[model samples]
Target chain A: MLFDKFKPMAEFQAELAARDVVPFGAVTEEIISATEGVVSGRRVILAGTNNYLGLSFDARCISAAQEAAGKWGTGTTGSRLANGSFEEHQALERELAAFYGVGHAISFTTGYAATMGMTATLAGPGEVILLDADSHASIYAGVQLSGAEIIRFRHSDPEDLAKRLRRLGDRAENTLIIVEGIYSMLGDVAPLREIAAVKREYGGCLLVDEAHSMGVLGDHGRGAAEAAGVEQDVDFIAGTFSKSLGATGGYCVSQHPELETIRYCIRSYIFTASSSPSVVASTRRALQILQEEPGLRQRLWENATRLYEGLQGLGLPVGPSPSPVVAVVLEDRSQAINCWNALMSAGIYVNLVVPPASPSTNFLLRNSVSAAHSTAQIDTMIAAYAGLLEDGLIRAR
Target chain B: MTQYQQYLEFMLSALEARAGAGVTLSETTRLVADIGLSSLEVMEFVEKIEDHFDISIPLNILPDINTLGDLARKLQEVDS
Candidate 1:
């Protein structure tokens, strides 16, 4: 009787199925997948997963993980403030600092938790949070929870941000400006140089979420800030290990030693259990491999360009700009579902983003190419989209 | 100008902008009837007001803002 109020799940599933956007998850995207269960009957050219650097399957990373598990016994059993701080965890923190050329770094359990902890520490009730309108949800929630007055600027428009800050006048000094490296849904990057300039002029701290661009951008893959050459300009650089590092955790790295003071105040860091030693070990190893190898990053960019231009050539209304993520825009919700189902039917699985997820704009098929993906896989993906375009499933002006 | 009259002008304009482009609105224009504030549209209007004035409009102020005059008067009072 207590469980009888679960009516929404059925309606949701029914509505989604009727529209045809069934969000399915799978294991991996090798020419031949190693796991069964999900992709058993699917041909899966796997383009939705955020494994940009393709280090999850790296032999060195797997070996490091196995060794760490043997040494640390699988779990940390406490928070970093308590008994969770292992020698490996401290080493990973140091490695992360050196990797980013910053003096301090603290790792969290997930990307969302990193943002939540970092933001909650930056602004208080009297302070203001000026965010880009299209920032990630974690950032939005973090500001909301911190009791900050969130003033959002137009997406990627620094002029709008300047106008908003001017409205705040003297109160702007207490403001924190937040932006992202590469937006997840549409796959567009922020105009960081202009944003950093404005934040500095306003005497505010800037936080850049490098979640989607780590291990994929920059000459050293130090994330998008490095790619933009504005590392020193930003106050807090928040990033996730889950996407490119092939682990589930987040880190807030900065040169400010006082940034470490947030360790005591951030609820997400204080409460959550520290990431497993195996995770840290793997990320460290992944970083080493990322630095040691440059060709992998090149292949990733090559694939991204191929898919993006291919979609454009097919005239399928790809996203406005070029990045690793290529989105096929279909404005109608049902059309997005149909296109998603069409991809799944072709044995190609990608993310089908709809209204709310797509910045209150249109529906889209969001895809990400990996460094591990070969030309053959890219060609197959392009050919499938070419078919869709020829059939007029995705229309263009 | 008197706060009442200033409030009247603001409401008339806000109602015209929010409800429709060419609607003739007066001081006593009911947000629910004349302007027709669906829950979503009401919140969007509240956002515009907050953004314009650079103030935090408490969520509680929403239910009481039933008319154009009421909204403008509330803004004046909050500003003061």
Candidate 2:
């Protein structure tokens, strides 16, 4: 039966219960403040959220969202191809294109939808899509839905990619190379310069997913493509507002004026309902803040470095380089779950990433730093890791 | 060196280029454990081997091949 197909979820939930740990998607009691939240009736420091710029609680964003809600009401309730194309939505798209210094932009309900619409429309049967082996699952799903021949190259290896393209011969012209600005799991920056160079050598298009890198990299916060000085070389750039902008939506920007045509053809964009008025408004405000205020980026980096170095001082296996995200790698599932529980008990909230979803075979405690975090809050998170280390709940790498 | 030996040397050098110059590899080396290669890196190594010989290594054979020696034997079978 249809219900029988979900038996594995039941078994997984039972296993998590047997381990006496909080299951995934545990509801918070309340958001105490911007940087703190109440989970299971305890005040916990929010270190797991994707509020990178920490604008979710910004006064200007809230005011804009409220004003838009009052002016446009709650939801659009229709697709952009139909009646859902509000004035604010078009305005956001224009603003986004200008912000990224691109020729065209199209916004979507979610980041997943942005990539889904792109891949499902970009390539058809017989065409090839070459992507990083460790690309996000959304990219995989997008390719699967597109019915394109999916080929994976070595992660961040340009020479390997060149070899694969050389094998493809003339089929290389139809290839689309996809890579992320910063991998979500490892928080490591991509070698965009080398990848762009390879794309130039081989006849192919390049798409950079900057979902995690936007508002965190570059002087203008245009993401890793801009930071690597290969912005003009990239053909497509997909990003999300949920992480840095503190809103729920995604967008694809390109220097090609033909990109606007996707709005009419892509099923995900044409059939699905557009983003709400408040989300669009708030996202626009946050985009302004992301550009106007460089101090937030500086504070975010400072906090990230402190947290990363602090975890290293405690002998933990943190991610390679310091970014807004600082992930601690664990050996096994039991160890990961145990540390997650220990951190929870100490009033620290972090993401528990397991196999399959994790980039590698290891479990991870994904910690994201926010610009809103104070020195005291950052200190508390570091001390929690130190305590876990002292208690032997976790070990050095 | 023989053709197979040259292929092995090429594979070792490719792995070392990413893993580091200090790394050492032999025919019996485990791709994941001994050399510290991620799943992506392993797939890339397989792709390089496939392109080198122009033979597609079926995914069904991946699970059985643990060491570089096993991979060499499998490639030999496919080559023949």
Candidate 3:
């Protein structure tokens, strides 16, 4: 038994099972139907997913991906160091760098990889990472991988950041300040302008992970940095093609030409296989469509606003305003599980996030609004939530 | 307040609040088999310490932590 060595995790596992929050993935839209699609059984609405842009099924994007595979073969077969850099990959990097209006950009195989490569490469032993308490697991894992001292401020509080930063004294110059454009679990925006101003005052570099917010924020969809009007001021912008672009991969763009220099030094990028040519190919097209079809941004905001309004009107614990993400906050873990299970049994699906994802237990019923979902689809979702409330399966906010 | 005394009161209130029910120990309490704190609750206690003392408690220090005094001693060391 690895239990002889790792005794405690098994205890945690038993707790998880008993809590009614199924740790295994079979409860909802990601359900397994034995090769038959859910349509043959019961139609399910996928709200728990992070498909913010909903371009995954776009005919053009899919066709372009298939076309690229025909042209470029299947896999890259190696890391980007040697035989892996495709015309698609190079072109995608160029398109992304131009998209963010930054001088250099590097793509990673996954959203996790982008964050790990930067945080681990930049900070090492004896250095510090000033992180938001609410930052994602990838960010936390990256800080751990970096071997840096991870210092946290209160969530989204720039005053806490400033005070904690002041404690590092002369070592502040060796600091990497990290925050999210929009926190994943909480569905809240950071005070980026205020946070950036403090980092600037203290002469620290800022790495903003716009994973959840990019292509959903700003009129132009540059991300929360642009939305906050600090695009030029931030040292690095790390975002996911997975979320807003409706594809899988991540990238970090920076004003520093030395940004590319980190690629050579970072182990995560150097060791792992590069993203498949098809993914890169699809993402490049997604970028083009992102700029051309600004109407998608408008539609996304419209859906998000509608959901926010519906939830708020229900007098639930919705987010403060028109965020692309909406969450119904709950306080008990069993209650959260009951609500999530009820949502699924009613053909609606949303993520049931619990702590360590957050401090609160019945934390969030996180639902994302996407461009592909129709007004009727959104209305159906709102109606389902209203029904959930009426059923008393999920408590009223 | 003695560092140990201040530590105990904070731990008692927060541990009682965050850990879901009353504890079976007092100021001299240890944090292992008696209470069965999940790793997360242990982390929460550490985070409370971090916030109270205005210091960064690296995650690496956690697995070895057992007794309340050990935690209090670590907090005092960090504070100094």
lDDT digits (tens) for residues A18-121 of candidate 1: 76455744433344531111343566777887778888777789899999999998999999889988998889889988988889999898999999778767
Cα lDDT for residue A262, model 3? 82
- TM-score of model 1's chain A, to 2 decimals? 0.93
TM-scores of the first chain across all predictions? 0.93, 0.97, 0.92
Each candidate's DockQ:
0.19, 0.09, 0.36
Best to worst by DockQ, what's the order?
3, 1, 2
lDDT of the structure predicted as candidate 2: 0.86
Pick the winner on lDDT between candidates 2 and 3: 2
**RMSD to truth, every model:** 4.0, 6.2, 3.8
Residue range with the least summed lDDT across 10 consecutive positions in model 1 chain A: A29-38
Q: Write the per-residue lDDT of candidate 3 for residues A193-290, one digit (tens) a residue.
A: 99988988786789999999888877689888899998877999998999877789999999999987888997888898889989998898888888
Query: In model 3, which regions exceed 4 Å deviation?
Result: A4-24, A27-40, B1-28, B32-54
The regions of model 1 sitting more than 4 angstroms off are A1-10, A18-21, A24-40, B1-80
Candidate ordering by TM-score (highest first) = 3, 1, 2
